[model samples]
Target chain A: MSTFSKTRPPLLETTRPTADQTVLRVTDLTTGFRRGATTTEVVRGVSFDLRAGRTLVLLGESGCGKSVTARSLMRLTPERAVIGGSVQLGDEELLTLPLADVVRRRGKRIALVPQDPAGALSPLRKIGSQVSEVLRVHGIVGTRQERTGRTLELLDRVGIPDPQRVAGSYAHELSGGMRQRVAIAIAVACDPEVLIADEPTTALDVTVQAQILELFQDLQARLGMATLLVTHDVGVAERMADEIAVMYAGRIVESGLAETVLSAPRHPYTAALLRALPVPGVRRGELQPIPGQPSAPSERPAGCPFRTRCDFQHDACSEYEPPLFVTDVATHAACDLMRPSQQAVG
Target chain B: MAAPEFLLEGRGLTVTYGNGVRAVSDVDLTVRHGEIVGLVGESGCGKSSLANTVLRMVKPQSGTLSFNGKDLLAMHGDELKAVRRSLQVVPQDPSTSLNPRLTIAQSVEFNLKVHGWGRRERRARVMEMLDRVGIPASYSTRYPHQLSGGQLQRVAIARALVTDPSLVVCDEAVSALDKSVQAQILNLLAQLQRDLDVAFLFVSHDLTVVEHVSDRVLVMYLGRIVEEGPATEILTAPRHPYTQALLASIPTRGQQRAAIHGEPPSPVNPPSGCGFRTRCPYAVDACAGYDNTPHAVGPDHAARCVRLDDLALTAPQAWRNS
Candidate 1:
């Protein structure tokens, strides 16, 4: 039996919190793209909740549908992409909302911190005005002068020195850490309830990366805003996440509190990912590489998506795709290894 | 016992760009025979310049670089050409390092042919290098685009080793790959070092990766060596303030991280005394005019900081008095 099954039934309360307390909620969300006559699924039945004052890390390698899931929450997926299922913000269903309404709520209710800070900010515009544009558009500030004043304050809050000078400088004038802090300033300008940071530190140096992460942690604690951190590095997840979701082939193979999932991962895919990481103390030449690349969205398998690379794959793994079965309401894994001996208890 | 013989020793090395921009300064480093020495610093710190100078890729304005008994800067023509073959460089991007049109085998064999090896001998040496790097002979026909990033890097490494160079400089050679691929390449490099006995001059900004691959570590700043010592001792208990900060700033796997507050100072006009004084949290008035010279802090532990004498004081007090 899984660890959660030993706990009492009342502790297994699966009643998800209401919308305001729960910053973002997704259910049976499926997203895909159509090529001529065929539809290729990129993200299938992905569900998770980002509540206020907690970090929900989407951990996966490239093409594991982590980004797709994040983009879907904002309805930022392209027109050619087909999206289904319900995404709720508090009580309102976002998936059914009009495009115009979605755009209105984009920066006001939720803000996105994209992967590349250097590419995200316009090169021609001064750093201060770019931040002011968001406040001006949302009518958050009355006058242009007031917007500039607020921009300086936000810059200082994100750890930039000489905010007035930084405000006048262009994107190229700033370093990588300074640029990322500017991006965070832009995201947190409107004081949104949810912030989605996608691989924000992937391109930075190690020292700068640690500073950026520490900044995020400090901001999260101060603002008490829910955060969705998307990264492929297990180390990044370990440092930032309160809860973790391990995605494989466009599905969450495991999800639980970060400490539990990280220290005691149950799924084979989760175990493989943890083993693949090159930790500092570990010897250099003794890497345990997970053989074979993750299957692409266009060429996924018929049964279990990870069967081809899974070390413990059985015949049943190919014959049937296991449903996401919960050992308790808090933790779940979609694998035959976790399949109970008896028919799943209702 | 006498000191282990260093295959390459660089003392008082200095490189200055035009307009009074010093790219490197009185840097001292050594890579011993059958050992790997890692030189780590962030972008613009001149680690790459140091490695390139060893290969004579960039001529230094001053300093002495000696491989065995010969001074590198003093060599020219045939002597320089012979030295270039003895030291090979594996650049950051393998795709750009290798000629896209050439096949894997032809790429490795080119160096042998340039050194005046006969056609038959070149082919045999190319095959041997290919096998050593774990690439099959059949892959000899494949172009750069056909191979994965990992495979491309292997081909780059094999090509560098084809001439049987005694010293190899890998500048972020495996930084571009995924974690698993990075592990595999590191393991391969370590195995190759053991089997081939070729000394490595490794340069990267990632401390964890550097610590894993290096026997000795050298921490560089703007354009100078701030600290140098055995890898484990330096990484575990760094004597220099900059080195300590660098190690403290790294976010290890599954460990909580402490904040690194400020950015590195611009290198164009580095501060007087020590180049790292501006960012060294333990800076004082004396640090502004202190002599910039390497001093012994412990056995093999050396740093170019003024506060090395007062280790018993509180952090803030040390900073005030440094």
Candidate 2:
């Protein structure tokens, strides 16, 4: 065990770089789907900044608009959907880019590591060719020889043991973990400035999931690319995120550094979510699951969306939606309980 | 002294699929009355096959399965159907398992009606079971689509328990749910187990969940039981390398653990001797030649490792502290 641990490269850098450079900035991004007269807003004014060479994890349960927010950044919404807000990647505003320009910039400057590795790859194509397709489309390499050489290099970089043999095999022939490694290889093939991974490891076993996460950390350090990861698992967020943003009912309720938000959550929903997880040591029946389900976009409450299920709800919490209150230098929470007057009332 | 009563028992259980792939090898498992036995393993490790075999959903190639001292494998026709009333299963996905067209009440009373119960008794028992699972009696009139995932799972639990089975098999029952909803369903299962004294064969890939709910835990690897002991002991002081690696793989709050390398070997062509030798960091030269057998490490604690006596294995710090 000691030999393996010593021989293996360090999974992640102990000290995060203090560069503090913002790579992707999203401001008041709202996405809504229109059907006839009713327009249901799925992502309501979500905002965050992703630092270069760091990860910002959007944590939420299903239907909380975390996935929609990620998709909106890439302009991947449906034709009928209405998108409002500015997504600035470096100096370019992605939302205002033309269709041809966005398509060019997609694989060239930004890439997506999607969930469902099994379905993400084309079943008809071999793994090596699929990875090479990215290189060809992005014009990362000029010659076919260069593409093949780069594909093997990328596969090897993602920690595939037998890259030569694996590249010849189809997606179905590889295991789930190996297929995910192939997907990551393709996503990083172009060395995109920003990588958006949506539940990349959710389908894998625990052991394989850890490996994929470690691979992401190593690649982020080596490539210095910003990563925006969206996952429903708190443990995944705890392990991967430099910054954490808690989303509920189509809005971010808390945003801050991972250690701050996880250790001392300000919002009731965030605290409840942490408490609800069945961590090892917590006895059975001691877990306090939040009482109610998240409200649907169409049935969102008038004030705070989480007021229906919050344990620390007050009369003022139902009167108006609270804007994010800056709790510390870098932490903020959108909850009435953050106010001194509310604390006094209690 | 007389042995403690076991609600479900299996000896030398072996199951092989049509492709000549042995999904489950000769294994022995027992569940006492009102106890929860958790089966944990990676996907394709044969945990599901063992669960399905015990439920009698799949016929075993060889085994002795007895539920309540009656031979389960020998029963057929009406006798099998009669015995099925005492064995129930709660599947992973509630939405797919339930008939979308049927109302919640109808789905809950399905087994009761199938067993030739009177309409009044079925209705009464459905209402009672629904209330027991924390669902309001009125929601029974609504279809499954009208309820949330957590509510639908409660309905599934209600349907399973309505027949009052002595043993229930939960195959990844809460894996589909959100964290909050998963906790609710787990708590509901624990509460129901205490209130009804029903034995549960809880099968899941999530180790933390299995630890919380199970009295005894069984770890499977490549169609064999690698470890079995009390949940606390197996989780905290794992004897097998596979179990230690699994316990360490979990991404906890503050601990850093080396991820286990390589995927599990294929069940179609598993390695000789120790099934876990391919990925285990502690595999030795002797591991390739030793036959698979459980070595007793302590009281009620056993592991399928040849070097169990020599190795000093401890779980990760997070698990030990937890």
Candidate 3:
């Protein structure tokens, strides 16, 4: 644990934004889809703030609404889907904006680096043309020559060697890591104020994934853009996040500084997730799996959604929905274990 | 030293696709009884090709494969079928691997019926196997779609192990699972190994998972085994440059990650001399002309690197310290 601190001193000390400097502030954001007569809520009031030059990672398991939450910010949910709550980029209200305005804002002010780079990119187009499309649509550059030059520059910035050859290659011709680098190059073409990456490296191999993550850090440092990284890997979250938000069945279960939250998680679900990882130094067979599967939104239990799998559940855990209880100055957790009355039992 | 008993052995295995791409080349592997040998590499590094060739699912161009003291490459017809009962496989995706039209009970029993088990014995054996994998008997009648990914994977394991196989080839068995479910499956595999004494050829890209379950580990690069040794020694003190880079790339909970440069070279026409020389940080001019062969690093550990003699290698953390 100390090794992490030794290698990279807290960049937040110099890059942390002061008060009232939040780049993207999401409040009580909820999204739902209606199929026939049934309406199911996929994202249930997930809220977090992304400050300039800082990363706030939404960490959770599959079907935990982390992806949906990222999608909700960009209004990328399916057609006819019901969306609620406020998504404010600075003074602009993104949720209530007109479709035309939202379309204009996308890829210019709020860009997205989606998961599955192979699927995110068009196989028919060359990597150069695809990246130049963002610049053309956003009007970031003046002429076609400028577009090509900027596209090559962005590719090189993302750590792709021999940018000219890569720019001429199609998506299928490039390797997985090269494709992902092209995706990031497009996302940062216009230098968006906020970059929402949804499991950007999930499909890559470990070594390639490490390279991509380091590229993200480098881009963030140079461009000073607020990054909202969505991933199901706790190890990734620990390495990349300045602030951490643990999401469960659509709702954030805990939020705090990465060091505080990862070192001593207040929520039981977060603790269980950290425990589930097969850490390098730990002996085999010592891993404790969280019992029961994560329930879908349609099958969410009453009160606390995690009570069904929680080992520390009591009568109060299922009796009432627990709110985020402040455990420290900057740490808050949505678990009954933090309640004064239930504290004794825990 | 006494000769060790090998449940499965491959000598100079080579596989080439129809497109003239050599997927696996000149590789030797052995899994002793009651041992778990993990095969790890990046995607498209011939891990799956090698595992499938051993399972007889894919034909090798040049190799001698033997299982349970029988020459697998020479077996024909009934002999091959008889040996297949002792060699089972659990594939990566449980959803696509299982028959969707069949119920869980029917799926598990299908294997036994193919092996010529009677009706009454097959039903009892299916029930017992399902229970052992932690799936309840009541859900045996449900379809594959009705079960979660974890439960479906358990059913897959139950089907593979119902015959009491002497060796099982788990190809990315837990890679698609969630972290918690992955832990449960790994623990279950370990428990089954202890009880059944079945040797497993575990293929995965996850080093952490491989280090946790494997007694010995083999690191692959560009369709070649770059390092082979005991899991503890290989992970803690790797001798090959590629193995060191692979270990350093793993994102531990609170450790700083080290990035390896560039993508792997194309297997169709890999770089001459060392396959990893193009991406190797310590490559020298001589590396381009040196022969790749096993260099002993320990009593039971060996690496295929020409620089093992003159160059000193250290773990990723050591670089960080210096």
- The models' CA-based lDDT, in order, is 0.81, 0.88, 0.87
Candidate 2 residue A85 Cα shift, in angstroms, is: 0.6
Across residues A1-346, which tens digit of lDDT does each residue of candidate 2 receive?
1122222112233333244588889999999999999889999999999887889999999999999999899998899888999999889999998868888888657889989989989999999999999877766676777779888998999999999999999999999999999999999887777899999999999999988988998898787888999999998888889999999988899999998898888898998998888877556878788997987788888899999898888898889999888774458899987765665675
From the highest lDDT down, the ranking of the candidates is 2, 3, 1
Interface RMSD of each: 7.2, 2.4, 4.3
Candidate 2, residues B39-78: lDDT per residue as tens digits? 9999999999999999888899998999888889998989
**Per-model C-alpha RMSD:** 8.4, 5.5, 6.3
lDDT of 3 at A333: 95
Number of backbone-clashing residue pairs for each candidate, in the order shown = 1, 0, 0
Candidate 3 segments whose C-alpha is farther than 4 A from its true place: A1-20, A340-346, B1-4, B253-257, B316-322
Instruction: Note the residue pairs that clash in candidate 1.
Output: A19-A90
Q: In model 1 chain B, which range of ten residues has the least summed lDDT? A: B313-322
Query: For residues B1-322, what per-residue lDDT tens digits would candidate 3 score against the true structure?
Result: 4444788989899999998788998898999998999999999999999999988888999989988777898888888888888899999999999999999999999999999899999999999999999998899999999999999999999999998898899999999999988988988898889888888999999988998888999999988899999988887788999998888887644454455688898888888899999989899988888677788889779999998987777665522110
Candidate 1, residues A148-208: lDDT per residue as tens digits? 8888988998889889999999999999989999999999887777899989998887678
- For candidate 3, lDDT tens digit of each residue in A195-226? 99999989999889988998898888877889
The lDDT of model 2 is: 0.88
- Calculate DockQ per candidate and list them: 0.35, 0.56, 0.47
Model 3 lDDT at residue A247: 91
- The predicted structure with the larger TM-score, 1 or 2, is 2
